[model samples]
Target: MSRTLVSALVYVLANGVGLLVASLVLGDSFTFTFKGFFVATLLLSVVEAVAGPAITKAAEDNVPALKGGIALIITFVGLLVTNFLVGGMHIAGISTWLIATLLVWIGALIAQIVLPRIPVKKAVQKARGKQPGKEG
Candidate 1:
């Protein structure tokens, strides 16, 4: 597999894990059926991959003060877009949208940080004919 494919897979896996963790943590307010979860995960991954950079750039240029908070904004927008575009996912019952946004942001942040440290990446590298212990 090419490096691009491996990178994309890693990103999708990270986002999927993030979404799963968020759903588990938030419980009823954020829920997804089995099919819904997969659909939502795919949609979220696409949205983040395509729109994330542009959104981050816009935020940096227009709202410098929001630099740190932009990730949360992007995550919230991604969730909303995924929910709107995919019928399987549902986000509801929150008194404020901030709670939902924060949950997703935190979950994604944790996943992105933690997933790379897991053996999954080593497995992927091994599958690609690369030695796990060697750094490129």
Candidate 2:
């Protein structure tokens, strides 16, 4: 499958397993599925922030803001399934997740700008059908 599809599947599986475990361990009062979704988004953001530049550089291209937005939507829905597995839904604490996302974004931007050269080179080579760690 495509890399994006694989990532989506991983995200869904991670959240689903988390929710199932949470439900079994926590009771009704543990109803914080929304929080999980938000947190998961932030988690994905952090992953993107770190791996994004590499992936972009490997391909020497950006997927466009629209593509990123669609990825976000897919991530959100995947988490939704996780929340369903956990229990119901309760978004009593969304601000925390937002804050975390912002922090992750800042970090991602910094890393991408500072250490982008290597990734860019790798992306370019990869795009040309060259192996990453071998002389062509």
The TM-score leader among the candidates is 1
Tens digits of per-residue lDDT for model 1, 1-136:
7768877877777778878777887788778889988888888888877888998899889988989887787877888899898887778864535676776667767777776677678889889989988976
Q: Which portions of model 1 miss their true places by more than 4 Å?
A: 94-96, 120-136
Error of 2 at 125 (Å): 32
Return the TM-score for each candidate structure. 0.78, 0.27
- Residue pairs with backbone atoms closer than 3 Å in model 2 (clashes): 57-123, 58-123
State how far residue 122 of model 1 sits from its true place (Å): 5.7
Steric clashes per prediction: 0, 2
Residue-level error in angstroms, candidate 2, position 40: 10
Candidate 1 lDDT trough over 10 residues, lowest sum: 93-102
lDDT per residue (tens digit) for residues 26-134 in model 2: 4452345556545554454445445545554544354454554443333334334433453434323455333323333343344434443655689899999998889
Please give the lDDT score at residue 29 for candidate 2: 26
Model 2 residue 42 CA deviation (Å) reads 13
